[model samples]
Target: MKPSIVLVGRPNVGKSTLFNRLTRTRDALVADIPGLTRDRHYGHGRLGSKPYLVIDTGGFEPLAKDGIMYQMARQAQQAIDEADVVILVVDGRSGVSALDKEIANRLRHANRPVLVAVNKSEGMQHGLVVADFHELGLGEPVAISAAHGEGVRVLIELALEGYPEPGDGEPAEGDSIRVAIVGRPNVGKSTMINALLGEDRVIAFDQPGTTRDAIDVDFERAGRKYTLVDTAGLRRRGKVFETIEKFSVIKTLQAIEEAQVVILVLDARQEIGDQDAHIAAFIRESGRALVVAVNKWDGLDSYVREQIKGALDNQLTFIDFARFHYVSALQGQGLEPLFHSVDAAYKAATINLSTPQLTRTLIDAVARQAPPRNGLFRPKLRYAHQGGRNPPLIVIHGNALDKIPESYRRYLEHLFREVFKLQGTPLRIQFNVSSNPFADKQAPREKRRERKTTDKAKPASGSPARPRSAGKVAAAVKTKRPSGGR
Candidate 1:
C-alpha cells in the first residue's frame, strides 16, 4: 500500500495548490477564498520512483461546533488520523495566527509525523519565514512556494524520507478491467457496487454525497478480475455551493479518465434531466466503454418504465452504442446480464483489428456508399489499421480525406462498428491524408534526373560539344606534351 501524506491548515494556505503540484494535476480547486476545500481530496504522487498518496482537506476550524466549519474539521481530522505524514501548510506572508496555533495543537496529538510548510515564501528570506513557524513545536519548517513550484520537491522528499522504495507488486497490465460508476447525486452507485460485490465493501447510504472520494474495490466474477471504482456523484456546478462538492466532481472525472469502462447509474423514479444528458455526453466524449444502469427499477410500472426508456432515447441518442439495463440494485434483479454486457464491452473496446481486415471493411463500405464529394475533391479512403485500443481507434490512410464531411465519417463509424461487432465501446476514426508526391514539386531523385537530362539536351554557351569534352581534350594535350619531354 502507498503511504498517505495529508495536508492540513487554515483556509487559503495554498494546500490545494500544493496538492496540484505534488500530483502534477490540477485536480484540486484553488482560490483566495477561505474554506474552499471541505472534503478530503486524494491524489497520487511520486518522488523519483517512490509512489505515495496525497490528501488535501479543508481548513481546520477545531473550535467550530456545529456548522459547515465543524464538518470540515471532522473531515480534516479523519485525514490526519489516516495519514502516515502530515504537512501543516501555513501562510508565510501573514505570520503565525491563532488558528494556525490551534491547528498545530490539534496535530500535536495526531500521533503522526508532522511537518510545517511555510507557503508563499518566494521572495522573502526562507530562514525568516520558517523561524516564525518553528514556534508551532513541529520540527524544522520547510519554506515552499506551492504556486511557483519552489522547494516542493524538497518538501515531498522530506515527507517521504523514511519510507522504503516501493516494490514491483503492482498488478500487471491487463490484469483487470477498471470500471468507474458515475452519475448525479444519490444515484445508487455505491449500492450497486455493494450488490455486485455481495458484501458491504463501501458505505451505501440513502443520502447524497455519502461517497466523497473515489473508492476502488477489487473483486473477481466468473474468474475474471475487475477493479470497481466507486466515484462521487456529480451535481450541477450552479448548485454546487460547498467547495468540497466542486472537487468531488473533479475526482469523478479523474476516475472516469483512469477507468477502462464506466457504469453510469441513473434513477428510474426521476425524469432524465440535463445533468444526466451532460454526464452521458461526457462519457461518450471520453471514449470509454459504457453500460447504463437504471437503478430502483424493481417497483416502477410498465408505463413509467416505457416513459423512462423513451426519455433516455430522446435525451441520450448520442450514446446509442452503449447497452442499457434496468437494474434493481437492492434486489440484484438485472445485475448478471449487466456483467455480461460489461465483459462484452470490454472485449470490444480492446479487440484487435488487423490492417488487411480493416482495409477490406473500408473498401466494402465505400463500395456500398462512396463518400460525398466536396466540390472538386473526392475523398478516397485507401486502407486502415488499428491505431489504439480500449476505445479502439482506426487510422485510415487516404487522399482528400480532409474533405470528408461529418455525415460520411458517421457512416464509416457505423459500418465499422457493425462489421467489428463493437457494441458497447465508442469507435474513433482518424484520417491520415496521404500527400501527393508531385503536388508541390518533384522528388529529390526525380529533380536530380531532370537536371541531368536538361544538361544533356542543352549545349554549352560557346561550344556545341558535350560539357565533359573540354576536360577530355585538356587531358589528351597534357599527355602528349609530357611524352615529348620524356
Candidate 2:
C-alpha cells in the first residue's frame, strides 16, 4: 500500500483546489463557495513514479458539538487516523488565524507527521507568510499557491518523507462487484454499509448530507470480494440548498453510473416520494442492476410495511423489475437476502445470450403476441442477436423494424425478461431496419425504354395489316368528285 496523506484545515482554505492539483483530476468538486466539501474525498496522486493516496477532508472544527459541523469534524478525525501523514493547509494571504492555531494544537497531539501548507502564496516572498505559521509549532510552513501550481511538489515530498516503504504485495482484486448505496438524506445508507461491513467504517449520523463524497469500502464476504460505496443523500433539485450539496449530488449520481449494482435504500418510515422514483428512473436509465433496499424495517409494523409496498408500487411502477428487500441496517436484519438479490441482479445484467437462442425467443414472443400491422403491411420480423451487455442489449435486424410499436416493444421486453430471467436488470431491445436492394434498382430511362418496346411490339402471329392501296383509292375518288361537282 502507498502512503496516505490527509488534508485538514478550516473552511475555505483551498484544500479541494490543492487536492485537484495533486490528483491531476477534477474529480473532487471545486468551487469558490466555502464549505463546499463536507466529507472526506479520496483520490490517487503521483509525483513522478511515486504513487500515493490523498484524502481531501471537510473543514476542521474540533469543538463543534451539534449539527453537520460536528459530523464533518468527526469524519476529518477518522481520515487523519488512517493517514500516514497529515498536511494542514492554511490561507497564506489571510495569514495564521485562531482557527489555524486550534487545528495546529489538535495535530500536535495526533502523534503523526504533520506538515503545514500555506496556500495562495504566489506573489509573496518565500519566508514572508511562512513565519506567521511557525507559531502553530507543527513545522516550517511550505508557502505555495494551490491554484497557480507553486510549491505543491515540495509539500507532498515533505509529507511522504518519513513514511515507511511498501512491501512486495499483490495488486488489489479486480473482480469485485462495486455496489453503490444511495438514497435520500438520513435514510441509513451509512448504517447499511456499517452493517454489511460489521464495523463503523463510515461516519453515520442523523443529519442530512452527512456523507458529502462517495466513499468506497472494500471487504470480503462469502469468499467473494465486494466494494461498497457510501454516497451522499440525494435531495430533490429544488430542495438542494448548498453549493457543496449540489457537488455531492453530482458525485452521487456518478457513483450510480460507475457501480455494477445500485442498492437504493429507502426510509421505511417516510412515504414513497417522487424523489425516490426519480432516483429509480435514473438507475434504470443507467442500465445498472438495481436492488431496492427498504431500510429500517425493524420498527415498521405489518400494516405500515404493506402501505410502504403499496406506495412503492404506485410511485415506482416503471421499476417493478427491481427486486425489493426489507432490510434493517441498524439491527443487521435481512442483509443476506439483499446481497443475494444484488448478486443475481449483477449476473442478469451481464449475462450473454446466444444468437440462435435469442432468435428462437424472439420467434416465440412474436407468436405469443402477434406484432401489430403497419398500415397494410405486417412487418416481417427477422433475426435477433445479442448486441451488448450491462442491460443486455438485443438487436433485431429486419425489414421495416422501425415500424415496431412501443406497446409491442414493451411486450417484447417483458417476454425477454421472463424468458431470460432478467428480472432485476433493465433489458434493451434495438431495431435495425434493413432496406431491400432490388426495390428501387430500375432506372427511369430503362423503364421508359421497356414501355416503348412493349407498345411497338410486332402484331401477333397471323394478325392482318392495314391495306395501303385502299387509302390511295379513297384519295383518288375524292379528288375527281371535287373537280367535277364541288
Q: Candidate 1's residue-wise lDDT over 111-161, tens digit each?
A: 999999999999998998899888999999999999999999999999998
What is candidate 2's lDDT per residue for 275-394, written digit by digit as tens? 888889878976778999998889778998898888888888898889999988999999999999988998898788999988999898878777888899887788899987777899
Model 1: weakest 10-residue lDDT segment is 165-174
Candidate 2, 169: how far from true, in Å?
26
Clashing pairs in 2: none
Which whole-number lDDT from 0 to 100 does residue 237 have in model 2?
Answer: 56
| The 10-residue segment with the lowest total lDDT in model 2 | 163-172
lDDT of 1 at 439: 64
Whole-model lDDT per candidate: 0.88, 0.85
